[model samples]
Target chain A: MNILIKITYDGTNFHGFQLQPDERTVEGELNKGLAKTLNKEVKIFYAGRTDRGVHALGQYANFYSDTTIDIGNLPKVINFNLPEDVSVVDAKYVPEDFHARYDARLKKYRYVVHLSRYRNALLLNKAYEYPYKVDPDRMRKALSYLIGEHDFNSFMGKGAVVKDSIRTIDKIDVIEEGDFLYLDFVAKSFLKNMIRIVTGTALEIGRGQREIEYMKEALKMKKRKAAGPTAPACGLYLVDVKY
Target chain B: MNILIKITYDGTNFHGFQLQPDERTVEGELNKGLAKTLNKEVKIFYAGRTDRGVHALGQYANFYSDTTIDIGNLPKVINFNLPEDVSVVDAKYVPEDFHARYDARLKKYRYVVHLSRYRNALLLNKAYEYPYKVDPDRMRKALSYLIGEHDFNSFMGKGAVVKDSIRTIDKIDVIEEGDFLYLDFVAKSFLKNMIRIVTGTALEIGRGQREIEYMKEALKMKKRKAAGPTAPACGLYLVDVKY
Candidate 1:
């Protein structure tokens, strides 16, 4: 059977989502738990890779297995072998050729910025504490410039080796809840550090340190240095993916 | 100067809120941070002590310090000395006779119960996952039996050394948000493990394992064994202390 599993993880202690030989990674741990649960060597395909300290609420993975365990009990059974920070929330039989990464879909990501004057201990490693003054209206105006397809070279992270910098951003929503501001991004796929860079630049605009037109100017520059600083990975979360 | 500080903490890694000789505790970390920030041998009086794995959103403490640091910047200064899991959110000058514990008018606590079919990795150590089916109406009815003044001996934990078990529960609110249930308790003070036991019993009522009238019967019995099991400490939070 081809099994597609839904996952949720707190990525504070993970190096990232990809596998590493010596370092701890989400894929590494998932492989371990799958091995222990299935009692066999199994290679898995993950939906996407997240940066270090970036959490995921609805990451997906797929693998082939011959186990006869009840489908309803799969998540609980697999969770017993997984660590507390990561769990398989769901499992289901999918088309034999379904691919976790190559299946065409839209992805939603959320970046949380804490606007409180004091750092919140409860939100440690879960949000970026940006204590400076900000206006969400300014941020919304700045973000409007990035809607639709664009060459995201200016927003891509340094050391990225992607040949194609063109990506389509379907929408960006700036939501304020209590003392935190949430930036929700919907896209087919995101470039490395694209959302973080956009968040940083929008924050600069929100603070009145940069004009609203700066976002458009930076995108046109087509250079990483033209964009604002990359926001920390802790504030980012892979909210979900739709196939 | 007499300073009153409001704190927030993630209690997963600590022994509890009280100071212990060798165990890592919230009070130990607070004392360490306060001493380093004030540069003096400082003693603090906490509003209350929470059990291990019980978090605090607005825990308060008071201390006498002669430091000249600006009041507005004190939380930031002390936060630098504290670990990531505990933070001082606010600090203010108060009268010398003020006491964190005795001067409190009421206390509020929240107990969260996760009712999902599967465990949520993000809510690990943050909620009690009870997969059994539950009825909020039944739980509410069970909770109503404990309102107002009561001798809560049946709900107190083992090894408690208090001479009196008489306490007043000002209110108990049963709130359901998504797949989680929140029980908010308002009282001047509480017996050890009182909320957890009440939650466990109420959950039994919610699941039909026991009838709603069992709650009143247990209270009247005034014996610890008459109540249900004590829920885990992770679901409990010291929401705030009112002065």
Candidate 2:
């Protein structure tokens, strides 16, 4: 049977979501925990991969398991085997051939920026502290240029190798709550580090370091150097995946 | 000159807010950082001492310092000396003798209880996971019995030394947001572990383990065992102190 599971992780101690030989990654931990709970070596497919130090509140995965454990108690039993930084929050039986990656329709990501003068210890590895003054309205204008379908080569991370750079952005929103600015991005998919690079560019415009039109010019140039620096991975969160 | 500083800490690693002979503590870190910044040994007067694993978002402290560093840059310079789990967010000049503990008019504390069946990794040491069903309305009914001035010996923590057990409670609010329940306690002061005990007892009523009138009976009993168990320190937060 194919079992679908919803997962959440802190991601501070994880190398990334992919399986590596020796690093502590989210996928590696999930595999270990699921194998222990199911009493067999397990292979899992995830909805998408999140980079190192990027959190997830609603990451999804699917695996084939013939265990006798009830679906209602699967999350709890699997949680007992998982570490404190990761957990299987929910589980259900899906179609025998269901795939977590191929069946996803849309993905939502959130990036948080703290606009405080002093660093908050509670948010040490949780948020990016940008001390400079910024106007969210300026960022919204810059972000408008990146909406819709485009080849986001300039926004892609340096080492990412993708055959196609064209992707559709469903929506982009800039929201202000307290001293933190939240940037939400929705798309069917994204190139590696695309959202982080977009965030960095929008922040530059928000702080008056660059004009809003720079985003359009950078996208047109289609070169990595044309975009701003990549934002830190600590501020990013995979908010949800729509199936 | 006396300087007042606002502090924030994650509180996951420290032994508590008090200075100990051989333990990592918030006060110890503050003294160490202040001494490093001022080039002299220092002692600080804090608003109140929080127990181990209890966070603080708006803790206050005062100390005498004649450092040459400007007050505007004091927090930043001091933060450079402190560890990653503690930070000084603000600093200012105060009167010659302003005590953080004595002149305080009110204190506000917040306790978070997660009602979700699965534990959240992002809130591992930040909230309490009950995993059981609870009704906020039932908890609120029990909390109302705790309002007003009372001799709260039943709610006091073990090994606390104090001359009086009487404290005045200004308000008690149980707020429900998302899958988490927030209990806000306001008072001139509180007995040690008072809020935690109240929360534990209220949760019992919320989960139908005890009657709503149990709170009034427990308060009148004036015995330690009359109240419920103390909630975990990780679930508590010193929200603010008002003078």
Candidate 3:
């Protein structure tokens, strides 16, 4: 059966979501766990990849295995071999022809910033400690400039190798809860470092280091150097995906 | 000078709050840090000691140092020798007669319960995951019976090393946010494993497995077996101590 699984992982202990030669990865653990449960080598597919230290609250993926594993028991069987940092939240049977990556859907990413002067022990590795004052209202005004389709070449990092720089952003929201500031991005697809770069630029504007119009000017310039530094990967999280 | 330091720690990585012969502890780190900065061994006193795997968000402690370290720089100096899991959030120079343990007027403990069917990856070892359904209202009702001055021998664990069983609870509040239930306990002091035992017993009453009258019966009976099992240390946190 082709089984689709929803997973949540703490990426602090992982090198990244993708596989590396010697380093431990989320995909590596999933492959190992799947192999043990299916009693054979099994390949898995995922919705997207996260950078090092990036967490995931709702990441989707799928795998095909020959066994009569029931839907309710899939999570238990796969988790038997998985570690504590990685866990399967939901599992279901998908069509044989379905592809997890190619499926048309919108992805939602959430970035968290700890606005406290001191770091929090309870939220270590879960949110980035900015330690700087940022006005959420100003940040929201800056986010409004990127609500529609645009070439986000300025926000894309230099390490990104994507040929298509144009992506549609359905929504951008800045929410504050307690000492945390959350940035939520809804998009069909995101270029490498797109969300982090936007967050960094908006934070600069919120700090009054840059004018609000800088966001529009940076987009028109289409230069990575014109944008702010990339935010830390620890603050980013793959929160949801809608198909 | 008597230095007052407020600390926060993730106890999952340490043995406990107090020092041991060889094992790592919060007091051991403080002593090491203070000794390195002051160029001499310094004894550290704390408001209370937490069990292994229990965390602290606002634990108070004090140490005497002859070195003239600035109040603003003391946290930095002490944290230099400490581990990543333990951090000094606030530091100040207090009067020479001030004591962290004896002079405290109130101590507050917070216990978190993740009321969900599955474990949360982001909160591992930070909150207890309870799969079964529980009624917070019932638990609060049960908690009211244990408030005020009472002899808590029935709720104290077997490892308790205290001569006085009578303690006064100033306040008890139960608040639920999202999928987590927070139980805040305020008291001048507590016995060994007292909060955990009370939490476990109250949880049973909340689950309807036992009646609320069990709380009154347990206190009058003054037997450890009369109470419920000791809850895990991960969910209990020393959140606040006021002098």
The CAPRI-style docking tier of model 3 reads medium
lDDT string, candidate 1, B172-205, tens digits: 9999998889999999999999999999999999
Tell me how candidate 2 scores on lDDT.
0.93
Report model 1's interface C-alpha RMSD after superposition on the true interface residues: 0.9
**What pairs collide in candidate 3?**
none
Question: Which of 2 and 3 is the better model by DockQ?
Answer: 2
lDDT of 3: 0.87
User: TM-score for every candidate vs. truth?
Assistant: 0.97, 0.99, 0.93
DockQ, all candidates in order: 0.78, 0.86, 0.49
The residue-level lDDT of candidate 3 at B156 comes to 83
lDDT of candidate model 1 versus the reference: 0.93
Candidate 1 local Cα displacement, residue B196, angstroms: 1.1
TM-score of 2: 0.99
* Tens digits of lDDT, candidate 3, B40-108: 998888999999999999999988877777787777667777777888878888899999999999999
A30-137, model 1: which lDDT tens digit per residue? 999999999997999888899889999999999999999898899999999999999888899999999988994989999999997789898998999998889999
Question: C-alpha displacement of B218 in model 3, angstroms?
Answer: 2.4
Q: What DockQ number belongs to candidate 1? A: 0.78
Best candidate (score: DockQ): 2
Candidate 1 deviant stretches above 4 angstroms: none
How many residue pairs clash (N, CA or C atoms closer than 3 angstroms) in each of the candidate models, in the order given?
Answer: 0, 0, 0
Q: Which ten residues in a row have the lowest lDDT in candidate 3 chain B?
A: B74-83
